[model samples]
Target: MPAQPFTALAIGEAIRRGELDPVALTRQCLTRATDSDAVFISLTEQRALVEAEACAQRQRSGTLRGPLDGVPLAWKDLFDIAGTATTAGGKVLGKTPAERDAEAVRHTAGAGMVCIGKTNLTEIAYSGLGLNPHYGTPHHTPPPTSSEHEHESRNENEPRAPGGSSSGSAVAVAQGIVPAAIGTDTAGSLRVPAAFNGLVSYRPSQARHSRLGVTPLADSLDTIGVIASTLEDCLAIDDTMRGSAPLVRAAAVPEQSVIVLDAGCLDDPRVSRAVGDNLEACASRLKDAGFHIVRRRVASVADTLEAITRHGWLGAAEAYTEYRALLEGPDAEAMDPRVRKRLEAARQMPPDSVVSLYRLRQALKTRLREELAGATLLTPTVAHVAPLLAPLEADPEHFSEVNLATLRLSMVASLLDSPAVALPSGRDDDRQHTSLQLSGPCGEDEALLRVALGASSALTA
Candidate 1:
């Protein structure tokens, strides 16, 4: 009603229809950026202006690029923007600017999307918690900038977290400051934040989007993903970010054949409640929408999680080795200690174990396609809603327990080498939702997105 927040596609169309000026939009975006302390890390104000002007000129000439032409978006700071050095959430990456943008940024720009700035992220994009000590953590969208100043959260007693590692990107979109944002998901960086921020997001298959110039966490599982206001917006960003022009595949069947995960492994009461409630509601919607929903056991549900544990995350180990030099300095001491400790796990993991993990990953991927055909596997994006920050930060055990649960379901996609996307199911006791993950066989990015689209649409309905 009040300038509907989930309308990035309409925003793009408004620009196309000449009802909005790209330059003015960029200026407003930059103005918002100025006061978005802690929410945004870098402002591409000057560059955004240049691009916006060009888009406006093209509009005047009636040569506008495409759907997202003149639209403004932000990249998670983990991405390397052209002429902006990627700090990757660490101060050690000093004043050096990137010579070129990451492949997704370049593609998005080529499609006429303007980069407002880089959003904040977890240091080295490690934690799903989005806690960064080097660069500040990105908080969730605050109350509106109005004289009334309605406190958005309603409960002062409840602390907030935006989720990670794409924390600021989600905050940016959720706050109505950006149409969409980009972030990487080696695990659930894109999905976690989206769920926490109550926005639409998708992590397409691992290699669906190019990884060139994106700092890698796990070479095999790392993927560039998007956060937007709608499923269409997610699909559009996907199209713009691909090398071969990503296409959303049509449904193999008119309805989703789903396996409702009955795994008892989810011990967290809060997480189980959020996930269980949503699954029940979603199953009902799918049935009403003419999709077949069934409560059935998904094979390898627990085994896959066990595999990820045995793997100890090949990506984490490799990422630690990749950034070993930068993480060794005095700057490392200043980083969020939790983040530093997480990276230390990488150093301790044997390379041989990492190799073993990759083999397991490939095998599990085969299991998805070969063993489970004509069905989609559903799991909670996070075991719980975004927790109060202090407990996780102050208590190592708390952080460990939360991190394990958050990543437990997400790591399945990495282990299986399947394409997984997290969809916001519905609000629960926390007035928010646990992200629901849908994973498909290898290279089924399109199918995964379509399923996510159906789920997201149903939730809003």
Candidate 2:
């Protein structure tokens, strides 16, 4: 039989049919996880094998847990795994291991998913660019060296950014080391990385998943999300995490308008023509798929940006509140400078500013919902494809500029409390990936996921 695609649903089905042994699958994933660039910060090989052995036994007894049973996955290092340090991709955290698995981890484990290891991330899940000074950034594992041929714009040797705070999680899946992984999307951490790596990522409604035992970034803005190769896989992981019933057939695509925002940022010089073209292609596909595509300018989007500019981001304020002690403590010197700088800046903002921004954000969310009522909003997940890692790391100014620009579109969804999914559109001129994001009204995640599944197929096709 042909090898199944590297996805939870595929692997688990094989395990259930007794065609694949769970212990053997666990070993394979562990081997690949170690070989897949710098994706994993730590590997739970022994425990994973033990769990897989049990899963295999259960399969023999006709006690299969679910679609994810016996599947291997990596967790972003920020999640607390029992007896492991929750590093948050920073050096400052002490060596004390967590007492138990994070709530989400426990949920998945209970559903029989094997935990392969802890994946790396941007320090404290702070940046979208995924460059981490402490835990080295995980890049797309460069294609093997070959003397066969070479192209001018392409060097098979140079590594590209994997999209961040959830950098390692994306790399793990993209490299075929795992079927899926968990990530936090405070401001596009999950979506940006998924876009850069050419994978499926779903940012559920903020209130959908429990945040307990997960390291906080921006408590209010932060959301639990999954990165996988397909929306079905993401839905499976999400369903397991939420302890929901088996996923039913996705609802048929709704015949509603999709608002495509074309503003300065969308047309900004930083956005490559190829990226813009991909966005257009995605819009064209959606229109061809029987959905009305409306080109419109939303003033509330400007309001969202203005609020961020006038008052520091709500995430920045909230993250500062959560990590201020560590930032100001004696171990402060050990923190990543890039992350430290941002947190320090947020610390300087007045408490009243955060309060005012929160109010403004709420009002803007209301305005955006009203403006986009009965329709979904679409945008390029990021301005450009995965950037070369070296140049950005060499220049902090450029890093900061690109980082903010990359977050420009996805951050809007976060600000408005919308549930969004970043679906791969296609590859660009450099053969790097780009994605189109579909963000719907809050609490409408299920419906949006269904629409996205259809749109993703059409856009990619």
Candidate 3:
């Protein structure tokens, strides 16, 4: 039988064993990109080909670099990719190229990965829904066909948003075109799409993954996260992205205890049900395996809820700063009306209000640590599945009202500075995927990824 598609560890081993050539792998990804929805805004085909051939030569010469040598990754457009334009999904950025890839991309390069190209994103990474009239939304597809499983027919009008910012990255991995991709998160950007695509995603604790080449959304809240097919695959990529390599993520999750949050702030009934069901199932599995599973309603539930409110730091403040110049340009007519309105709200916020939001953020971070006491907290990634864009388009007021509800729990993981991972919960009656969220202390990315290992299989199965 032919080998399974790339997983970071699998690909690394294949490279070491002389069974896979980086050049061949890069070409394969480039071919896939060409036939797909044109989801990538720009392709680094020439450069990636050059790097992959070099890696192939290095392997034969017995000078193998570290793991991920010659592996391919689809970069979210916000990250500078050396020669590609860093147009965080805006018409204004044009084709002005970068001199070098972002620090995280450089780190991945150091590990021997080839950059295939830049993926599509939300307009300025503002909206949760992945609909981009600017670049193009990648189709949210289920895993490829197999004879045994019954598949749902595509509903072109029902609703399909691949979940923003990381939209193309998630779609690429889910459709089996790539093994892994990188995306940035401020307000649930990375995890949302991972859930939508039924893949695994990891959001490192703030600054845990390097931010040197990433265009700033909210510097304090910005985190570079990975979207991959599995937990172990994500871990392999995360280790390569971090500044200092960790021996293991064990210290962050300690063998001691795990807690499940009574996180009911989610507005979508389908999302709430999927999370509740999966959390119970995960808790039972952990207990049966001799892991201490604690059921606790955390005190910071209110603070977690507050993180999604309009006045929060990553919300209005960051959006306002990101678009200050663009909002004045002639092309402002091309901007999404709703996105434009949100950024405009940021301008009205008092300077003092932004400061207070940061202070509250610090307080919330401390609150989560004390509440968790070095234990892990698990919940659902979103309050609901992706809502129909028609409803938002038809009832603008309703969209504004419910956006907070969808992001409620995720914003907590971001605001509290905890490392978080979104595991797939089973699909709903509608067959839309749901994600169960697990969070760890300030820098516990690896631990969150590990704990999520066993349960993620349930999301679609």
Candidate 4:
């Protein structure tokens, strides 16, 4: 009878108290999603209602599976949901309904979470900008109370990039259609969208979770992750997907050391004044909160960038290999032209260069791990806030430039196989959300997440 709680954990708590019906909550989410455009590739109404009913029965009988049981979530279309087409934001892929759920989906279902639907993404999850010419792009509509002054200065209807390849996942949560969503990050898919939409995203080390049944862009770099409204929600979904009970909560802000990378370390000219200032302010807040803040350059960070500059993206070369058949086949005509161009460009990378990049990545991973021994590294999630969509959509060159810039910072974590969390720091002068990323050594996901909880609290406070 009352309005449904807005977060997954809160909804689960209400259900536990016999204060909310999972069936009613599912229907409410379905209704909201049905009215949205370009956010969902397809709705799993029958499946969601069925799952919610079972969860309700479990709660009634005192057989609840976990804390997130009965919570609704959207999966990026790259993940296979039995009986739903896994479009991967392409006109050509997943024409037939998948026969089974992705490994992550199966785990979440095992925890009793409901699948509301599949959200749109960059075609083949290739671009940083969440544009899907085939499915349309989902724009982030700033909440009315977000910033009244900024709303009056600019057209509220002006289209901006939603950050992709998890574009719709972020927007779906931002619009309050669902509490959380599953997405993948090869370079920066999950974090970029979260940054743009003012949400939290966690990209775990590639080895921390199962990737089975999920579509792959680059088997080497692709990682499945969660996008949600808070760091706690991200952690809960992460635990469920890993087949663990949701036991991790934002614990006491642990006394930890945090390394703030020098702004000059990025070597990216596109890094904006607003982003830099906000990152510094966040560092100041953390320092004030008793975090040992060390400001210096990380050699591994510089080395990784140099390797990328010399060899190009290792993922691009791998992606070309994964989809060469489709890219060369006649069906390639159906692919987005921008995506096609980027994939084709990888063809120019020599075989030896790809191998060298792989070797460099392994070496850098070790270097990064040794550099941060239980300490967290903080950096800007992206060099800038979401850019206006119209200009980028209208020019392929501009699109490519912005896409590379958007992914610059996130690629560092991917290459190092490090676990990272992107948290909304504050709004820019334009009132666009700016984000700060906290990352740590590879395979140190839990530790980094704990540190992030503390960092997030300090920054938001």
Tens-digit lDDT track for model 4 on 289-310? 8888888888888889888988
lDDT of 1 by residue, 86-143 (tens): 8777776636888888888888889888999988888778878877666666666433
Error of 4 at 347 (Å): 0.7
Ranking by TM-score: 4, 2, 1, 3
How does residue 48 of candidate 4 score in lDDT? 98
TM-score of each: 0.90, 0.94, 0.89, 0.96
Please report, in order, the local distance difference test score of every candidate based on alpha carbons: 0.73, 0.82, 0.73, 0.88
Off by over 4 Å in 2: 1-5, 141-157, 254-265
Q: Candidate 4 clashing pairs?
A: none
Candidate 4 local distance difference test against the native:
0.88
Give the better candidate number (1 or 2) by lDDT: 2
Q: Which window of ten consecutive residues has the lowest lDDT sum in model 4?
A: 142-151
Number of the top lDDT candidate: 4
Please rank every candidate by lDDT, starting with the best.
Answer: 4, 2, 1, 3
List clash counts for every candidate, in order: 6, 0, 4, 0
Q: Candidate 2 or 3, higher lDDT?
A: 2
- Checking candidate 3 for backbone clashes, the offending pairs are 69-112, 70-112, 102-213, 425-459
